[model samples]
Target: HGEDDHGVHDGDGPIASDPSWCDVFAAAAKNVIAEVFAHAKTPVETRRQLQKNKMRREAARQTRRTKVVRQTTVTATRDVQLQNHDDHRVTKTVSGGASPFVSAASAMQ
Candidate 1:
């Protein structure tokens, strides 16, 4: 690729535009791609945050549900114990035992 007498290579006509057009076009393309990617990144970040919040809320609800279940179990156990204690007192009263209700009451206290 030898240059002609007019410094134009390959017998082509004189150049009309800037010689750095390729570099300028490449820089402009890179800028445009970066801007598009930046704009597209917002929704991804927002969706990630939303998913995290949703998981937190679900975990909170599950914890509350588990706590309620545990409390219910404790209450049921207490109720069964009280009913058995009452049954024992009635049996002792009818059978002439030395009144086990007093001991049960004292234990409860």
Candidate 2:
């Protein structure tokens, strides 16, 4: 019973008993496993990309903060310079015989 040994039925014939069917199933299983691995890897890659974008955004925000601080410092320095200039003008006008109170009032304005 050579056919009985291979478990081949008369109705199904040689194609059903072929070893190639096992190979086909193995290949399909391998493909499915590969797809599963790829899907599993995707989130890790996406997380890394998200981290990089977050770092970039943080760096840009820090740069904007630094620029604003620098601008505020410059504006403050300019204000001090203008105040000094007005004080000097008030002193000169008082020395030139102008009334001290009027010079002080004009400088305040």
Candidate 3:
């Protein structure tokens, strides 16, 4: 058994909150943490597995974010293209309305 490390706050005393402690009653503490502090004994394999799981979760999160960003970008560009086409078509119609063909048709009314 060693001192506690959960508290990093230093007091007026000589570093009473040293995190370098590991205590292993059922197992060996030195195999977990080298610091002279109190910590639970964890298996190396278990720790590695937890790290890998975290990495996988992070990768999945990044992939989802990328997909959403890509979809949104594509949709926005498509909308812009549609709007541009609409603007051009409306301009052509408006310009043609002032021509003699449209005026002659209106004069027939």
Instruction: Note the Cα lDDT for every prediction shown.
Output: 0.79, 0.83, 0.66
lDDT of 3 at 52: 92
lDDT of 1: 0.79
User: What is candidate 1's lDDT per residue for 45-99, written digit by digit as tens?
Assistant: 8768867999999999999999999999999999999999987877677578545
Query: Best TM-score goes to which candidate?
Result: 2
Q: How high is each candidate's TM-score?
A: 0.49, 0.54, 0.52
Query: Which tens-of-lDDT digit does each residue in 1-109 have in candidate 3?
Result: 2377444445433342333422233235454455333223557786688779999999999999999999999999999999999767655765777656555545776
C-alpha displacement of 81 in model 2, angstroms? Answer: 0.2
| Clash count, candidate 3 | 8
Ranking by TM-score: 2, 3, 1
Clashes within 3 Å, all models in order: 0, 0, 8
Candidate 3, superposed: residue stretches over 4 Å from native = 1-39, 98-109
Q: After superposition, how far is residue 26 of candidate 3 from its true place, in Å?
A: 27
Winning model by lDDT? 2
